[model samples]
Every structure is written in structure tokens, then in C-alpha cells.
Target chain A: MKIALPIKFVIICSFLFLIHQIVQAQDNEEKIKMPESNNVCLNCHGHKYFSFYNENTEINERKLMNPYFVIDSISYLQGAHQGHSCIDCHSEDYGVYPHIAELKIEPKLTCVDCHDFEAIATEVKKSVHMEAFGEFFQCELCHDPHSNKLVKSDMAELVRYNNNRCLNCHNDVDKYQVFTSHENPQLLVTHDWLPNQALHFAHVRCIECHTAVTDTADAVHHIVPKEQAVKNCNECHSENSLLRDKLYKHQLKEDRSEFNFYKSFIINDAYIIGANKNYYVNLISLLIFGLTFFGILTHTIFRIIKRK
Target chain B: MSNTKLYLYPVWLRIWHAINALCIILLGITGISMQYTNIESPLINFNSAVSIHNLVGVIIIASYLFFFIAGIISGNVKHYRLLFKGLLNRLFKQGEYYLFGYLKGEPKPFHITKEEKFNPLQKVSYVAAMYVLVPAVIITGVALLFPEMIIEKFYTMSGIRLTTFFHSLAGFFILIFLIIHLYVITIGKHPLKNFKSIVNGYHES
Candidate 1:
């Protein structure tokens, strides 16, 4: 009975410790500010060319030398989860020096695991990626874990940030091929019909044209098919530019208006040919044109009468 | 000798004028088309208009350079010289003739001369149009074409937007000038006489 009591007590203590560890793991989520990742696992995993020895085959294999296994410490330290310990998300089995082979297939953490992306998921349901890629279309494909940052510093930064994400997959034929089975898909050739493609790409985000128009900026997740994309120039060029809704939608919360009457182009810094029409300027210009035309018409009548 | 005509429009000047006129017309059409790109009822396809506008802009730069160099070399630039003394008085007289005196068949307030090709009003108008507005558009156009060279910001506003505003405004003024020019050409001896003078390089003095 004495042996049984000690054993039972030990088992109870272990169960409590397991629960405490699980609770600590969850608490670590909030504890991370700018994760430095002081985790001991980084000693090997953070190496430029990390590899492991296969004991079963008695072969010195570099299986972990694949780019996926080696995390670039510089970028990892700069990333959102920079403060995170590897085990915070990864399986505890990873603590083993020569990790068990099955640990590789353990359900890995995804962006959605931490982020409340229910709104985005709803939008993504309508995306071509959802239909074509299904679950294979992950956030990491567009947003590389290492370099990811929600760029909101300025308009220029936002444009560059947004464009870089799209080009990562779209511009690289090798990477692009992985997504689409279409033979020989070239970004330039595909966009040949678009005038000044370079200029458009540099200034605007790909999602401006590719995504479905919605009130929320998260509508970016709803990337429509190419055919459904905005091809009409007037759609963005008109006074009621769709860009005001899509690309610059982030700046909507702030008062973009300048000088009460002066808005649109001056504040946004976009002088879109047809989109940034000034009401007062247009009215005055047209009035002058009308007066000049009328004056010419009346003068012509007088000249005709004098000659006759 | 009194009946002898002045060879006002030289070969180079004629060629420059023809090209400039054609470019202005094309640019005006394309500019308006680009500004009001109605997909449903477009005057010109947006891409086509942009291509045409950009191409003409380049040509205008070359054409203007030719005019600038040629005018200085040819001494034809002397005609643009203005005397500010009694300039407003002369301008008012010229304006009165066009508005009322022309209907009454009164003599012209200022006649075209070899030394003074343009009247007081014409001199000022030509100087403002050629020296002021045209160069304004050209500068702004070049800045817009190569935006990297422009100032990043003008006050709180973007330099690009301000440049576009200036370019568009200059183009608008040019459009108004073009209409007035076309109409004024009909004011000479015969409706088509001024037009023929430009082509044939002769003007009755």
C-alpha cells in the first residue's frame, strides 16, 4: 500500500507538470515582443548548411541541408516571431539531436494557427487559388516567413512590399511553374497587352488589378482569375478610381483631404490622367472655353453681316 | 515695289510651323482622350492615345529644339522683339479693330512688316505662347516622362502631381491658342489668304 501511494502521487505530479508546460507554451505566445529566438535548437537549425547523419543506412547524408531546414538567422531575428523558441510551435521531438524521421510530417504551425484570419479565409474561399490550389495555397507561398512585415511606412514602401510578394511567385518562372501547369507562362508575355507594364508594376500593387473589389482591404486575399481582373483603363483612370478603394484603402482611416477643397491627387500624390479631375479647375477651364467659343461664333456672325 | 510681297515664311519656318501645328492638333486630341477615357464611348482607345501622346511629346521636343536653334541662326527671331512703350495702348487699338473696326471695314491698327512681323498684341501673345506656355509644357512633360529627376515633394503635395497639373494647364492654354489662331487666320484679305501665305511663303505687305 505504501509503494502504491508513492507511485500514484508521482503520476499525479507528472500530470500536473504536463498541464503546466502546455499552459506555459500558450502563455509564451503573448510573452514574445520581438522574438530573439534564443532557443538551443537554433544551434544546428540556424546553420547555413545544416545536415544530419543517417544512422540506419550508415550513410553521412545532408538531408537537412535543404534550404527549408536552415533558417537565415539575420532574417529570422528580424521576422515577426523573432522572439519565439523553436519548440513554441514545433513538436517537442525536435529536441532530439538526430530527430526521429517521422517528426518531419508532424502537423506544422501555419499563419492561421496564430492569426484570426476568419475574414480573410472567407474572402480566400472565392479566390482562384482556393479553387486551383485548395489547401496547398498557403500564406507562406506569397509571404516568405523570414522577410514578412506588414509594410505601412509610406505609400512607396507599401507598393514595393505588395509588389515584391506577388513577383516572388509570378516573376520567377520556376516558382510560378510550381503553381500553374500552363506551359511556358511568362509574366511579360502574359502582360504584353498591358501598356507600360513596368510602370504599372512599380507604382501599383498586383492585387489592385487581380483581387476582387470589396470594402475591406482583406479583399486582397480574394485574387480573382486573370479574365476577371481589371483590364479596363477607365476603371482606374476615371474620377472615381478603384485604386482609392483598393491600393490606398489602408490610408482611408486618416483624413486624406487637404485644404478642404483640394483632395484626391495632391494628398495621395497620384496624378492619374482621368482619375484626379479637379472640379473647380475643370469648371473654370470649361467656362473659359465656352466663352471663347461663343465670342468666336458672335464675331463670325458680325463678319458675315458686314461682308454681305 | 509697293506691290512686292514679303517672303515672311521661309522654308525652315514653314516646315517648323507645319510640324508644330500637326503636333499640337494630335496632342490636343490625345490629351483630351486620355483625360476623359470613357470605356463605353472612348474617342480613342486609352493605350493608343497614351502611345500617340508620348510619341508626339518626344517629337515636339525635337521639333522645338530645331525651332530654337534655327530661329536664333536665321535672324527670324527679330520679329518677336517687342517695344513695351505704348504696348497696352497699341494692344487695345488692335483689340478694338478685331472686335468692332473689322466689321466696319476700318484699316488695320498695325500692319505686318519685315522688321516687325507681329503687332504689339501679336508680339506679346506669341512671346507668351511660344516662350512661356510651350516651354512650360515641354519642361513638365520631360519631368513627367522621367520622374526620377523631379523634386520628391512640393510643399505637402507631390511634385509629380504638381508637374502634371502644370503640364495639363499649359496644354489647355495651348488648345485655346490653337482655336484662336485658326479663327484669326480667317480674318485676313480673303478667308484662305493667310493659310496660303503660310504654305507658299508669301504675305502681301
Candidate 2:
């Protein structure tokens, strides 16, 4: 009986150990890399060359029916959805694709479905994008969910990135017409009064001038109309250059060094007239002025002393 | 001392001179401070300086227009004319008087007459200062005010930089001329004679 009881006790302990391991294994499964869970769906959707206008345009005049599904795996993995699984917002039925056509009718998910972005929505309501485009304006219009990073780019990259976002719609006629029937305005022709328009475009973001100056966190989205945009030279070409407050606002701490090619004002490589101040140049001018004044003084003293 | 009064200065001339002097002095003060601004110790705040500079710029342009139109209409510009024949010889003689003879109580180099308002050296310097430097500063100042008119690039430097350099250089030369102009007023007979004439429209000779 003692041997049998000991054997039963050993069996019970072993069973409990097995149960503990099963629970731990289940916990570990949930903790696996979220990207791996998305990999199953990516195998079918992930393609870099898969574009909206593909070779089969002649076959179907209608827009591609499955345009949304073609997510480039490289970009998807790099998106801000590091914590999101495919089923986080999408229906779990999507994970098991090629099975049911009924699954295709599943309602599309929005940013607010998973994220607590009520603040962003509130900001958009007050934005010019919403005011001009009406209720059709959404976050994904400007920010692509497939590949958006947090604010991490440096000043130069940020300029290019922000300007590109503006030009994507502004510089494209078809894209601009998608929102309104108005004829697209030519950028160069309209801005003929602005000097070095091309160079200005490369270094400065459009939002710097187009947007109203707001202390709000979403100041960028609050664009002003054409008449209201900053046109005054003093705004940028002064001692207190608004460039620091606008485009370079991100790098003020790191970029407060002495001016070089970009010195005196607006940019690092360009010399704006009002904002230029070189120590050596000023010193030489002052020395010449002082000597002139001294020589004048000496000449006057001579004329006075010689009047005998 | 010669005690004959001459109507060398007129009312229009006096008014123009007053306004021009005030505007130029203000422009010099504001312009120099702006060019050599020290963030820690600025003579004028940047915004205020630019605003003042612009306002003064407009006033100066108006004064210059008045001077130009009145000088032509009243035949005052004729005084600036110089005879190119023997001009160098006359200039040298006048230069010699100012340099050595004036202090020794020598006779005046060029007598003041209705037709001869300025001496040989005075004609040359006044013409250069009024014609070359004045117009140069005005054109460049307007260009700076409306920077859109300036070309994007010059030969090697930015058009704005070149414009700024020329503007400052011209302004500096004007400032120097002002000092010399004031000093030479003390040259003939009585030092305060010219100052009184500019203010009261009569030069005692």
C-alpha cells in the first residue's frame, strides 16, 4: 500500500508539472513576434513590384479589385504597427484566406478602431485639408499606414519629406482633381515673385509659409489660404529668423552654431541680406570708419592750429 | 571781412537740405546698427530697425525727387557744371589753396559770383557725390526693398549679396563725404558763415 501511495503521489506531481508547462507554453505563444503572425497573410500580399497600374490594364478597364491587399512586406514590417497582429483590427477570417468569398464583405477598419486617436480626428476637423476637401478627408490621405515612421528624420530629411507630401497632391493634376474639379494651378507661374523658387523649394517646406503660425502641436495641418501665407521678407530674413521657429524648430538645440554658408539667416548655405553679420567683415568696416574719423579729426586740428 | 550779402541759398534749397540731412543721418544710424548687429547688445531691435529703415527709405526717395525736380526747374543744377578744358589745372589750383594757402590768409582761390556758385574742386566732388553715389544708393536701396526685382545670381556671388555690398559701400562713401562737407564749410573766411547761409538763405561775402 505504501509503495502504491508513493507511486500515485509521483504521478500526481508529474501531471501538475505537465499542466504548468502547458500554461507557460500558451503564454509564450501570445508573446511571439507580432510580425510572424502577419507573415501568413504577407506571403500572398507582399510584393514590391505589385503596383496599381499593372500589365493587365488592357484586360480590365475597371480599377484593380484587390488593390488594398498588395502590401509590400518590406514596408509593412517597417510600419508603426510593431505591436499589431493581422487580426488586431482585421477580421480573424482574413488570417485564413482563399477560403470564403463571404469574408471579403467584412467591413473595413479605420485608424480609430485600434488606436485611441480622437485627438487627431479633432485636429483634422479644424484643418484646411478637411475644410477644403469636406468629410472625405481622412488620416490615410496624407499618412500612408503601410509605411509611416514617428518624427525621427533630421532637419534636411524633414524638409524633403514634408515638401514631398505637399507636392504629391499640389504638383499632380489628376490627384488634385480627385478632391475638387478646379483646374490645378501652376506652381512656378503663380510664385514668380519669389526669388530662387527652386532652391527655396528644396530647402524650405511649403507648410512653413502656407500654414498659420500656431503654437498647437498640430500646427502643420492647420494650413492657411493663399492670401494668408507669409509673404513678408522680415519673417525669415531678420535677426530672429522664423526658419528656426518653423522648419529648423526641430533642430534648434543641435544647430545653434555660428553661421557658415547657411549663415546669417534662412539657410546654412545661402546668404540672406538683412540677416548677414560676419565678425571679421564688421571689424574691418569699423576699423576703416574709425581711421577715417581720426584722420578727419587730425586734419581739423591741423587747420585750427595753423590759423596763425 | 567782406560784408556784402548774397542770395546764394534759396528757400527750396534750404528745405531740401534740411530734410536730406535728417533722413541721411537717421539712415546712417539705423543702417550701421543693422549691418553690425550684436544680438547681446543691439543699437536697435531687428524688427524696429527694418521698419524704421523702410520708412526712412521712402522719405529719402521723396526728398531726392523734390531736389531733382526743383534743381532742374529753378536752374540750380547749372551750378554743378564744369568746363572740361583746363579742368585739371583749375582743380589743382583749388586743391593747392585748400591744402596750403587758405590757412596762410592768402586771397580766395575762386571768387563767389552769381554764375560761379562752386569752385573747380567743389564742382567735381559735388557732381560725383550727388550724381554717382546718390543715384547708386537709391537704386540699390529700392532693389533691396523689393528683392523680387533683383536677379537670382550675379557672376559668382548671389545678387542679393552683391547688391548689399554695393549699397553699404556707397553709404559708407556718403558718410565720409558728409564729414568732409561739414569740415569744408569751415574753410572760407568765417566758419559759421555757410551754416548761417544754409539756414537763412544769405551768404555774407
Candidate 3:
């Protein structure tokens, strides 16, 4: 028993000693390299000795100032156009840090890059503001470059300008009054003279009385030719509501030949009439339909059992 | 005929019974949670609860088809036939007893046998729920899911508003019935008797 205990002790000791040697050898080996920096700034900032350095030259150059491209450089770097460098916009004489002294070109808005003034001018000429209403003396008279106050697209700037200009020409009694006697009445003071004559002074105009614009898009409307002017008039006057409804009924007519293809919105009576009265009857029909289904089921089951 | 061990249910019936039971429990929990979102669900995520309810609905339908086919093939249509016969009297009496007599410690009006496990009242209610309510709920749920399809066809053929109203009303009724049915299940001989029968496909004598 003594011999067996000593042998067991020797075996356990040898196993533990082997584990200790392995652990000691592992501890003597090289330690693992830690990350030099934590954030994205460190990705391009590490040196050969594993110290932090601002090694990306492009990033360093961006921090420096360039004179020739001063405005372009700041705006380009600060805004979404930052990905591009100074040479992209300020082409020649870009290498020198102080940059070559340059003449100031006219500052342009971002919108001018996509727009051609000549094309827009043609459309503006045919607009209501230019024709019957000389509200805008010219298109540029109302529109400004940077602030863009009156140039909000498709708004009723024409009506506002027209009312102001009309009052300027009509505020005097000489132009409108015919009989100036005390007993006699002026035509403008007559109760049945007009509906919106006072409203005109309150900044309402001809378009408010004669033309009904749908949205902002229709505020700046184009004048159709005399023959085609009848089409715009048809909106207020319909032939028959039922006749319009029957045109785009998708049931019997398998083909959509008569359907308005522009927005694919079925321009039916619902869109025009703006109210639906059939909902109540439809709900009653559905309840009746559900009841009828249960009735049929119970009847069939009873009939089969009776025959059996 | 003389054998004491009556093998009344088959493996398919057992499976259908278990799945149907699970669907009922799932629907009861999820449907209640859906009605009262302020209440904390035993399950996490209300959307997950809804998903479980839909999945359980599909499982119940599959199990129902299986049970229906088995009922036809096994000549168990007689069992359902008795449901229609004297249904009103049975339903009224059972309803009355539950309302009044059961409170006085009176015995149940009907007994369950292997052949006629569901009494007249039970069969009628089960058949109504299975054939009528289940189909109505399924149809309405399907219509709700594909509203645009129904609107496209029914707008000119019918009214979309009416279809939507019916679908919503049926859903409301089904949800109400689901709550009442769960409460009624608790009123069995013992509170756990119905639960045990559903789980193990057997009821105590």
C-alpha cells in the first residue's frame, strides 16, 4: 500500500510539472499587438513603429487654406460637394498654396446649372401675368436671385401684383365717375354694379372671378388657342353626370380605351360628384347576402336529412 | 360489440383534436390580447401574437378539413344529424339550465356517449361554429387582406365601403364569440374536464 501511494504521487506530480512548463513557455512568447487607435481617424494615421501619425496627405491639405479658390473651397468642402478637391472646380493655377490672384466672376445659384433661362422665358411670356394682367412688368421684375420671395413657383403672384397695380390706376374718382352731381349716383356705388369690385381693393383680381385654378400648378396657366379654349370651359359645364360615369365603367368594357391614361385615375362621377350615397344600401345587401348563405346551408342540411 | 375497450377515436382524429385544441387556446389568448392591447400578453410582441393567431387559424382549417372528411367517410353524419333534430329545445333547455338550474347543484340535462359525445345543443353550436362562423371569419379575413382586389372589382360592380363594413362587423362578432366560447369551456363538469378531453382526446366517465 505504501509503494502504491508513492507511485500515484509521482504520476500526479509529473502531470502537474508538465502543465507548468507549458504555461511558462507560453508566457515567455511575444505579447499580442493592441490597436493603435480606436476611431476612423486612426485608419490612415498609423506609423511603421505603430505610433499614431496624421499620414493621409489629402486630409492635411484640406486643413490648409487656398486663396484663389477661397469661396469654392469652403462651400465645396462644407456642403455635399466635399468629395471633390480644389482642382475640380478651380481648374488652372491650382498647385500653389496661396493661389494666383483672380478676378471675381458672377456668383451663380445651384438652380441655374439645370435651368436654361431662354426656355423658361418663352413659357412666361404666354402666362396670364404677361397678357391681360401686366402685374409682373417683366418676369425678372418679380423674381429675384438669392431671396426668391415672390418667385415661389405656381403661386398667385400674378393676382397680387394685378390688384396692387389696378388700385394704383383706379384709386382716383376721375377715371371711374361719369356724373359728379350730388343727387345723381356713381355707377361704382350701385348695389348691383359687380360682385368683387371691393374685393379687388382687398387684393382679389380678374382670375379669382373668371378663372378657377385647381392647385399651385394652375396659378401660372398657359393660354390655349381660341379653338382649344372651349376645353378648359368644359370643367364647370358637364353634358350629363351619368354620361361621364358610363364612359369609364370598367365592367362590361374589357378594354380601357376610354379610361383617362394620364394618372390612371378613373375620372368617374365619384371624383366629380364628390359624395357617395350607395354605401348604406351596399351594407344592407352584404348582411342579406350573409344571411342568405346561412339560410341555404341550413336548408340543404335539413333537406338531406328529411330525405334520409 | 361485446368488447369493453371501445376504440372510438383513430390516430387522425386524435391529431385533429389536439391541433384544434391548440388553435382554440392560441386564438383565445391572442384574440383577447388584440382586443385589449393595454393588457400585457403572456407572449411577447403583439405582432408576434397576431402572427401566431393567423398560423393557428391556418392549422385549424387544415385540421377541420381532415375531421370533416373523416366524419363523412366513417358514416358519422348521423351524429351531426341529431344536432339539427330538436336543436331549439335542446339549446334552450341547456341554456336555461346553465343560467338557472346549474346554480342549484342540479345534474346536467344531457350525457355524452362515444356515439353521441356532443349533445344536441353542443352539436348545433359546434356545427354552427365550424361551418358558419369559421368560413365567415376566413372569407372576411381574406377580403380584408386583399382589399384592393375587392375594391377594383366591386367599386363599379358594388361598393367598397359596404364590403369593408361587413368584413369589420363579422370580425367583431367572431371576436365576441371567441371570448364567450372560452368562458363556456370553463363551465364543464370540472373546470379542467374540457381542457383534459381536448388535450388527451378522452373524457372521464
- Per-residue CA lDDT of candidate 3, range B98-173, in tens? 6556555567788667777776666776676666766776665555444444543354433334553454455445
Judging by DockQ against the true structure, name the best candidate.
Answer: 1
Sliding window of 10 residues with minimal summed lDDT for model 3 chain A? A268-277
Fnat: each model in turn: 0.57, 0.19, 0.00
- Per-model TM-score on C-alpha atoms: 0.77, 0.58, 0.36
Taken over the whole model, the C-alpha lDDT of each candidate is 0.81, 0.74, 0.46
Model 2 misplaced stretches (Cα beyond 4 Å) = A1-59, A64-269, A278-284
lDDT of 2 by residue, B1-205 (tens): 6588889878989999999999888888888877755555678875677779889989998999898899999999999877899999999999888877886778777988878888898899888888888889999999888766778667645677678878888898888788788888888777897898899998777
True lDDT of residue A38, candidate 2: 79
Give the candidates in order of TM-score, highest first: 1, 2, 3
Candidate whose lDDT is highest = 1
Best-to-worst order by DockQ is 1, 2, 3
Better of 2 and 3 by TM-score: 2
